[model samples]
Structures are given as structure tokens and as C-alpha cells.
Target: MQLQVLNSPFSQEQAELLNRILPTLTDQQKLWLSGYLAASQFSGAQAAAPAASQNAGQAVSKDVTIIYGSQSGNSKGLANKAAKTLEGNGYLVTLSSMSDYKPNNLKKVQNLLIVVSTHGEGDPPDNAMTFHEFLHSKRAPKLEGLQFSVLALGDSSYEFFCQTGKQFDDRLEELGGTRLYPRFDCDVDFDEPAAEWLEGVLSSLKDAQGAGAAEAAAAASTLQTIESEYSRTNPFKAEVLDNINLNGRGSNKETHHLELSLEGSGLTFEPGDSLGVYPENDPALVEQLLNELKWSKEDQVTVKQGDVRTLQEALQSYYEITTLTKPLLEKIAPLSTNEGLKELVAQGNGEKLKEYINGRDILDLVRDFGPWGDSAQEFVSILRKIPVRLYSIASSLAANPDEVHLTIGAVRYEANGRERKGVASTYVAERLEPGDHVSVFVQQNENFKLPKNPETPIIMVGPGTGVAPFRSFIQEREETGAEGKSWLFFGDQHFVTDFLYQTEMQKWLKNGALTKLDVAFSRDTEEKVYVQHRMLEQSKELYKWLEEGAVVYICGDEKHMAHDVHNTFIKIIAKEGGLSREKAEEYLAEMQQQKRYQRDVY
Candidate 1:
């Protein structure tokens, strides 16, 4: 029997004894015994040969769940990395998006790790709406037996920064869940902090004495991913192949059509992905800051990254100087002797501080606060790292191999009696030349993707530069010879001057690639019709298309255009489906869940 059961390793009498002993051991004992055996094996492997052993420590794998709510893939990537790290450390991990998770099952989870990102104005990402609402609703279950942790990623510029993550953290605690690790709030430059937070959570879950080299090795693997070679922290240097001004002369907009070469970058992007550009500050602004601060251009300043460089170079490329935030004001207030600036950031001056920083910059702070005698290094120490600006990819890699494209709108305005320029936008517009290098990274947006099915119909409504991704979508569909009927509703100020990709639209239409083309130029008419108006104008046909399985997509401003479009959709549904507003909202929500409706609003 031993020879039959164990072909080569053991004799029959030994196998019989082992089987009898294994059956007598309890589940908990078996778990510990397994871990002890694994440790023994690891120890032996280390003695014989160190190269092949992973040294998985002595702890058994813990069951853990990780959920992510992502808008532009940051949260999702972080969650994936965390999951991979946890799994590599001998943890049984279950990873999922919030959209696919059932909220009612939260009570059953023993250990959970939530990684969520805050979208525009502190709203939850579209995939998280149902779970977010469910967690806050009365139907949420108590989780007294559950242990959880949260990693919140957000941009600090918004008033309600990391609102979704904060809500989750509070709600989980309120629902009786115990925190295994303290919640981590990460800013836009979140890579290092997030990694540190992951390590902390790992330390919390594992025994401090037993967790050895496995944690470090697993964590190192998490930093680099298999998806793409370039990340926000380590961007690719893509050469600017071409930069054309799309807006004609006399137009109020300064839209630039930038084509960059991604050759040999190992970066691949789909239609809905965005290209993040690390921009340089204007030389004029840098000069002004140096002059105002009375810092010598040659003065060396150590940036937050710990790299020492000239004050002028740091201002031009490292630290953020164009934008003003509440944190900056608070830091500057203590350094300055001005009472007004100090009062603005005082305990009871939240609203006043917000109001004052609306159209201000670093220069504004210096002018209003007065001369700070702090050294250049001291001043630079308090400043934040310059964040990358993401622009939707306007060209399909399938059509334009080895190249990526962007539609940039140069933002120039007058604020506080000084001409202010958008940091990234003006950098692309005025400073960047053909053959110049632009440090770029591809940010995948899975939420706003083209339909996988070739025969599915699509309706795209994009106003202004929002038309960028739609252009990629159309080009992709056309290049693929998709049999789907494609309709585009694009609007701007003028037909000729403000019309982005006009020639391409006409070419697509002439070649039968574009099934429908609708234009709404607000300045072209007296009535000021927009894309939502056009949707209402053609409501009957729009409803018919919806019934025929057409996917509706809206891109652009989230505050006004996306909101108006959403309301317009509800109204259309109510009128066509003959339902109440509540039912109409449900219908749209259902469509959203089914991926029939999507938005790429910024």
C-alpha cells in the first residue's frame, strides 16, 4: 500500500503512519504544522543554496480582500500592486473593483483593504457610486468582526480632497470594523507614500519577528508592474514630433495639436487613455519668483526629492510655483510678518483663505504677505512637487504607430491684475519645440473605453478639447473597419476657427466611417445652442438609437456640461420610456451598470 500511495518518496509503513497522524491532527494544528514545515524547508534551502529560495517566512497565508474604485487607473494600479504584494507574502488575496463588489457581503469579510480615488470635486468615481451609496445607506451591515484599512489617493487642490476615502474610513469604523492599520491619505505625488503605507499594513498583519526578507522582496516587485514600463514616477521621455496650433487666428482659444514619438518607450495606450506631461514652469515666472524672493539665481536649493539644484532650475522644473493652495498659504503665513496674510489663514479664516486663493499664485502670496527672510532652501522645502497634467490621447496607436497625440488648450487669463498662465498648457504652447523632449507617461482610463464589440453603435458628445478621446475612438473604429454606426456631436465657438479636427471629421464622414455628424457652434448662432440642446433637438431619434443598443458617451467639463447632459438624459428617458423622474434615473443607472452609458468628463 505504501509503494502504491507513495511511488518513490516513502515506504508503505511510513506512509500509513503519516496518513494516520495527519488525520488525527485538527485544522488549526495542521495549519501551524504546514507553516513549520515550510519554514524548515526554507531554512534547509538557505543552507544548501540561497539562490532558489524565496524565504517565505514562518507565517501562514492570511485571507485578505482588496477593493478599488478608480476613475483614471491610479487607485486601481495601487490596489493591484498592494494585492500582488500581499499575495507574494503568502496571503490569499481576493481583488475586485467596487462596481463588481456586493455591499451586503461586507459583514462576512475577515480582512479587507480598500484603495479608492476621489474624482472631481470630491465625488466618488462612477464605478463606486452604488457601493458608496450602499455603504452610507441604512442597509449597510455591521462589521464588528472585520479588520480593514484604507489607502486614499487624491489631488490636494480640491476643497473636499479624498472625500470618498474619508467617507469609507469613517463608515467602516462606524459599522464596527476595527482598523488593522491607520488610514493613509496620499497626495497627487503618492507613489512613495503609498508604498510606505503598504509596508506598514503588511507589518501590521504579519508578526514583526517572523516577517523577514519576504516582505522586502515582495514589496520591491510591487514597485514595478508587468502592465507597462513607464509610470507616473518614472516617466518616458517622448520627443515632440510636431506641434500645430489647431485654432485659427483671431479665435479666443489656443488649442495645440501635439504629436509626440513614443518609439522604443515600451508604452502602449488605448483610445481612452491619457498622456501625462511633466511640464516646466515659464522662465518669466521663474525670474519673477527669484526677483520677488530676492534669492540669487545661482543659489542652491534642495528640492523635496533631495536633489540639489540652482534656485532658477528648481523653480523652472522641480517645485510648484504657479498654483496656490491652502497648505502653501499656511506655510507662507508663518514665514511672513504681514498680519493680513496671517489672519487669512487663521483658525476661523477657512472661507476667507479659500476665497483669497481662488486666482492667486506664489507671486501673489509673496506680494500680499511681504518679504520672507527665509533661505531659498527653506522656502523651497515648504513647496510641493510639481504635478503632471494629463491630456486625453487624441490619436489611436493602432492608426499612428510609435506616436502619441494630444489636444491642449492653452489657458491664459488675467487674475489679481497679473497675467496668469496655466503651467502645463502654456509650457506646451510657447516653450516646447519640435524635437524637444517631453517627459510623459500613459495613464490608462478603463472607465472611458471604446466598446470591444466591433458592431456596437456609439454616440459621442464632446465639446471643446473634450473631443480629444473621441477623435481617438473614431480613428480606432475606422482603422479597424468596425461595422458599428458612429455618431459624433461636437461644438465650439466658431465653425472654422474653433472646430478641432475639422478635416478629419469631414474625411470620416465622406468615407462612411462617421454615420452621423452634428455641430453646435454657440458663437455661430444667436440662440447659443450646445450639445445637450442638440441632444434635446434630436431626442426622438436619440431614444430610437438607445432602444437599438447604442452606447452614449459624454466628455468634457464635469461641472456644467456633464451635469446638464446627465439631466438631459434623464429627461429623455422619462419622456420616451413614459416613466417618472425616479424611474428614469434608475433606468440610466442601469444603463451605466451595463456599460451602455459612460462619461470621460474632467
Candidate 2:
């Protein structure tokens, strides 16, 4: 009997190969192949069909709103791009900063998309501070009418990648909002992946809109005036007027007071904003790389972004010259003669890869890789883009209209018997002398602004360089002639050595601009004391201020100091307010929900 031929989408070679192998395959193998084709929709050379739009002709509203919470403006940039893309696709989109968003209006949103970045550890970004708290609170209105999506940007190297997005997703569902699409947790290299996800969302909600066509038409007709040029990707180079050592001579640490000119950029920012500065690698390190790799200093190379003259030039100008990633390790693994590198690559452990590269430079990598030659372009391909560092603006716009100031702690550490430096911090603190140019852009942080009601009491917790923004805050309040009471919690190892901006802080206190002053010199006495301990010391009064509508602010280390201060607040609420531990926890949670408690920890 002749058997009928089963024609499939698979290519002829694949079909023939499969048929030849079928007789020798087991039942498990056949089942696996069946499921693979069902899920993957491809077998060897089979071409897959495109997916149909999920919501075609579903009557989508003309008004689309994008809310973004960003610390360094990366999230906001991405959000703006998404809005622009949607507008180009014939949808009317309004972009709003999360800090400025009114929580009461969340229920009125129909087609909503959020782009938020997580801060240190797992906390929400600074701009999303209040919004995140409100969502988890009882005061938040039900979002049942909202159809939303979230694009959470984070660093996968951290333990909590897209933690803020996960929280938002969970909270929105709890409030009965329908998720239009699944939330995407994007890592550092988020550009391509974000674009892909956005396409999916555009396809899914192509037809979902508000009921009225006239209203949609009116909204859609309002065309967006996009910025013609200039962004983090293409920053304008500004001149550095001065970069002086803020710390007194003989001090162990190197801190700088820097000044840069905006000149003709037309960029203006308020006091609470930060300035993102692009820094080049140290010249000494670049020279070392050239010598070790046996490459000429004038060899030109092209990377993913643009072409640059010389491997040293590329490393200094375009790529991250210090930190190493898993991809870079993988790229060099085959050429590496070191047994440690070989074992690490075989294991595929990201953390171990970091360790292997830690405290080592490109020269070290080349040495370990032996005589295996690598082209400059190939080497540059493995490196990540040079990241911009954020520095809190120390001067208020009212004080310096044409310029910005920064308080930088020069990163100087010893590792492997060689001195190491912070990529951007040292660049600004030591390399860029007075009158040199530094590329910079303002990053607005509205969430960390001074209290709207001047009469409201404000308590600020900042230690080390965390004191940077508080200077601006106090200056703003003073300039506005605010009657609000102000309290500051500052600490360092010793009062004599690390009391940054001490003279200015004391002057403010003496002039009555500061209502209360508290200092926590950790190593002053035999026993160490931190700001949280001081908060505990004044628990009764602190709780009284909380009762009297005082606004509490915290900024500094997120891992330990922030957590310690948080615990201290709970203890105060429990003891001073005379509540149980569980109730105290609930009380603090309620305060967060009410936007009475806020943190700006890094």
C-alpha cells in the first residue's frame, strides 16, 4: 500500500532530515518536537506568520496618558519617546511627571502607560516616592476603570530588578484595574527591548479608546512639539568655570565645589534638580591599556554608536572604561589563558565575573588573555556605553541663573596595592581643573522640593555629601521668606574632619532660618551615634511634630541608614504615640499613604 505524504511548513531539507531521524527517535523526542512547533511556530527553515492585533476595531480612546517616575531622567526620556511614537501612530498622548500627577485622577484614566525606574535596592524612584506610597494606601481610589501597562527599567546586577514595576503591577491588580499587557522588567541595555515591548502594546491597544469621536479628534489634533535635538545621547558640552577643593587642606578626603556654565543651552532648573555630567576615563589608565594591548594610540575604531580615533580615545570618550560585564568576559573568555577566567566563563556566574574584573583594568585583561590579538572595534563592542553621573545641584537658580554647582566627594580607594578612583567623581574633582569644559544637563527632581506651606515644619536627614540638596532647600525656603520650621540631621565620623558645609549650616541656625539643629557625630564620643539614634533621643518632640503636620525628609545611604531611620520612626510611633508594634507599623504605613512621609535615599 502507498502511504500519503504529509506536507509541512518545514523546509525540504528539514523535512527529509526529520523523516530520516524519526525512526531512531524515542516517544519523548517526538512529543518534544510536536510541542516545540506548537509554541515556537518554527522548525529549522519554516517561516512563521505575524500575530494578529489583539484589539483591532475595539474602539480605543483618542486620549492616551504616559506617567513616568525617573530618578536620572532615563525613564522620563523613554516615556517621552513612547508618547512621541504613539502620537506618530495617530494616537493623542499626554506626558506627565509622576510627582506632579494627582492621585485622585487615577480612576479617570482609561489608556495609561507608566515608565518607572527603581532606585537603590528595591525602592521606587525619587519621583515615584509619593505615588508608590499612595497606591499601597487606603486613600488611593480604586483603579477599576483604568487599563494600564508598565515598563519598569532597572539594572539586573541588583537584587531587585524592576521591583517598583512589580509593586505597581500588584497594586493595580489589587485595586481591580485591568492590565492591558504584562509588565516588562528591563535591564540596563533597555533600548532595543523597550522598543519591542512598546510595539506589542501599540498593537494590543490599537483600537481601545474613549467613547466620543469628536473628543478623540480634538485631542488627536493637538500635535506635539518635539525637541528638535539634544538629549543624554547627544549632550552639549558646557565649560567648567571652576572645580575647587571644598574640603580644607590637610583633610583626608578630597571633596570639590564645582561650577559650570550653561552659556547658550537654554537649560534652566530649580534647586532640587540634579546635573548629569559625562566624564572621560583617566588619561593614565588609557595609556596603560595602549601599552599592554600593543596597540597604537592612533588606531581608529568604530563602535555601536560612532567612530572614534584610537582604542584609547574610544575607551575614554565612548565606552565604560572601568566596570566590566558578563558579555565582556564572554568575549575575552576564548582568548584567556588564565584558568580562573576559563572556569568562570564555563560556570557563567555574573557575580564571579565581576570579581574577576574587579580592581583590574583592560591591561590586566589583555595580560591574562595572553598573546591573543583583538581588534579595537571588536574590543569596544564588548564594552557598555559611558554612563552619565548625577550630582545634586548645590546652587539655587535664584542664586546662579547662568550656572550650576556641585559638591563632589572624590572617589579614592585602595585595591590590590594600587589606588583606584571613582569614574565620574574623580574626573570632576581632580581631572577637570578650573576653566575646563564638562558636558552637563539638568535633571529635575520635583518630589524633593521644599514644603509648599512655609509654616509646615521640615526635618531633613542628610550626612556626608547628602547635605548637597539640603543647602539648596534651605536657601530656597529662606529666599521665599517661608515661616516653616526647619530641622537638620547631619552626621560624619568626626565633627572636625567631615563637617561639610558646617559654617553655612551654623549661620542658618544662628539667623533663625533653622528652627532646630541636630548633629550626630558618629565617632565623636567613645560610643558611635547616628542620626537615627538622635531621632530616638527626641522621639517625644518628633512625634509631636508629626502630629502637628510636620513633613519628614530623608536622603542618604539606602541600605543601612535609611532602614535604620525607618525602624527608629516606627519605634517612636510605638512608644511616643502609645501604640503596639503592629499598630505602629500600620500607622507609619498610613502616613506613607497620606504622603506625610517621604525618602530620597540612593
What is the TM-score of each predicted model, taking all chains together?
A: 0.89, 0.76
lDDT of 2 by residue, 11-76 (tens): 777777767778887899989778755644331122111112225524335467899998766788
Q: lDDT of model 1 at residue 223?
A: 52
Error of 1 at 269 (Å): 0.8
lDDT of 1 at 200: 80
Residue pairs with backbone atoms closer than 3 Å in model 2 (clashes) = 59-209, 60-207, 60-208, 60-209, 61-208, 61-209, 61-210, 454-484
Scored by TM-score, the top model is 1
In TM-score terms, candidate 1 sits at 0.89
lDDT at position 48, candidate 1:
41
Local distance difference test, each candidate:
0.86, 0.75
lDDT of 2: 0.75
State the weakest 10-residue window (summed lDDT) of model 1: 45-54
Steric clash pairs (candidate 1): 2-12
